[model samples]
Target: MNGQPGTTRAAVVTGADSGIGRATAVRLAQEGLDVGITWHQDREGAEATAAEVRDAGRRAAVQRMDLTVLPEAADAVDRLAEELGRVDVLVNNAGVGTAVPFLELELDDVREVIDVDLVGPLVCGQRAAQRMIRQGDGGRIVNVTSVHEHQPRVGAAPYCAAKGGLGLLTQVMALELAEYGITVNAVAPGEIATPMTGQEDVDVLTVRRPGVPLGRPGDAREVAAVIAFLSGPGASYVTGASWSVDGGMLRMGPHAGSHLESDSWRRP
Candidate 1:
């Protein structure tokens, strides 16, 4: 909103200590926006991300946030907005995964996943949208979901449910926020070579993922590029959409099912 004519813009990227969140924060900074980075338990990684944004010659702010606490989560948005002086773009990238089976999962497990993944984003988005509405200018909100948003995975009942909920939430937000010139969309990524994928220090290309058409895990920067596009002026007409950055994994459902000869897929 601020970058249209002569004003500067700022973005808040939650869960930006590392992985896709860190990459997106840096990408937005490179695109001529100040960045606000947030972390839950990785303050060092958040500071490093802030350094990367500052290295790009953009203003950067870092804060620790526990998204499970909805009020504090919303407060995190306000804190970053105040620090950056504006909140033109918001990337709700803070999320957690639970790989427990549905029948075996404890109530706490499912609730924690939902609280952080669904409710936290809902609150944070509301807070950011309110600020954007007050600014009277257009803004962008990109929710980083997962491939599971569109499909189910084994041993990840809570993660899948939370992502599915978020997918629909993105659409509803897009519909409601359109009046305020705020575009809401999602980026659903597949197996990426991040800490979440158990290969934080390894090359994504080296990771073997035959199910993906790309035949390997994706890099965090690849997903960040897609997120950056949605947040930019070029995607003005795009909203209520989930951009899948999964190396065609979703498209390989039939092939994957047929190729699986073991009962391993059924066990989870």
Candidate 2:
């Protein structure tokens, strides 16, 4: 879906302060779209991303967003869209996870994960889609899920639950928004070299994961490339699909089940 004939496109990418969020913001800027960047705790990082966007000859707007705050926080999406004139694409990339075992998890922790990972995106998607509908131009929405969205991971009960829910939510949004020419999809990533994974600034190629078909963790840029494609004109026909950037990790389910040599994985 193209924007007004001669106007530049604009996008709002949540969690754009670092990792995949930062990468996606910059990549979209390179695609000739002005970007609205959001940061939860890293204002400096968000500014850096904005600077990169500016360097790419596109406008950038930065906002601090706390997704756990609910419907109020979703307002940031509209603010960014306003600052950038209009929002042609929205990438819901902000998320939180927990490593606590199921029995040890507290209600607050679970709620926090659910708020940031699931509910928050839903509201933000609504905001962006509403604007797109009013503009009368088709739009794009990309939800960043995880491989856990399809499978399970020990010590990540709430995380998996939230992601799985988000996966299905993506499908529903696609179905409903398609009538307005707004396409919704999800991008599921595997282990990536990012701050969330405790691998910030590390070279992914230097590390090896024998179990992964790619033999290494993914890079944030790698994930951003996929997201950029989905946000571009080329992916106008693709929606309600979950594109896995997991180095074939999901395909190893049966292979890994048969190759386990110990009970270590059973512990979280």
Candidate 3:
């Protein structure tokens, strides 16, 4: 994502049909930018998000995006850029995970996870950056990685690998795209109270996660607020960094050794 100093800010957020993507699209709209939203299996949810953005008095364009078809996924951003007349932000929030154990996980499942979580974002980010580079002003790209991006979790081998790879990819993109004035970053959310976690229509502020330091599940808006910061003027100097919005869940690792009172944490 690259934009000039005076360019109108527009954003394309994948997986916007629900969850963090939806919150991000809405939040960016509230911040005064038009939004383009995409989804693979939920056009209704995407439209709902569009309505929310419109309610915020911003234009919204909805489309289908499936990272399994890499080119089509990338092209979704182009379509949005055309509709919004500019592309200043690209939030790569679409991702999938498999819970099957490493030994039991199918090759196809691993392939799908890698394609959706890692390669998909890489390609989509490149497309957005290319447009931003052409636009002559730098822009922003925020990849919605996961806590797994920094550490592994049981039964999530493929997801951990893909997010871990995406973390490094964010750095590489930041280094290369900096010349064009584009900033690339990642937002690693621990456990957001959204449909992905079987917690739809949730009040994020009240969600609890006893396992984390904050003792709460993060709201999608909390994560989006961080993404908004990265996309807005305040984060102009920030790039190639991964912001953790997981209620400090990532910091619990060291304490687990001596604090284990039960095996509940190991339960999936």
Q: Return the top candidate by TM-score.
A: 2
Give the range where candidate 1 is weakest over 10 consecutive residues by summed lDDT: 257-266
Q: List ranges where model 1 is wrong by over 4 Å.
A: 2-5, 257-268
Candidate 1 contains a number of clashing pairs equal to 0
TM-scores of all models? 0.94, 0.95, 0.93
Backbone clashes in model 3, listed as residue pairs: 1-139, 2-137, 2-138, 2-139, 3-137, 3-138, 3-139, 4-137
TM-score head-to-head 2 vs 3, winner: 2
lDDT winner = 2
| Prediction 2 global C-alpha lDDT | 0.93
Residue pairs in clash, model 1 = none
Q: Please, what are the lDDT tens digits per residue for candidate 2 over residues 1-268?
A: 8898999999999999999999999999999999999999999999999999999999999999999998999999999999999999999999999999899999999999999999999999999999999999999999999999999988999999999999999999999999999999999999999999999999998986776777788999999999999999999899999999998889888556212444454345
Residue 111 in candidate 3, Cα distance off native in Å: 0.5
TM-score of 2: 0.95
Worst 10 residues of 2 by lDDT: 257-266
lDDT per residue as tens, model 1, 97-154: 9767778999988888998898889999999999999888989999999989999888
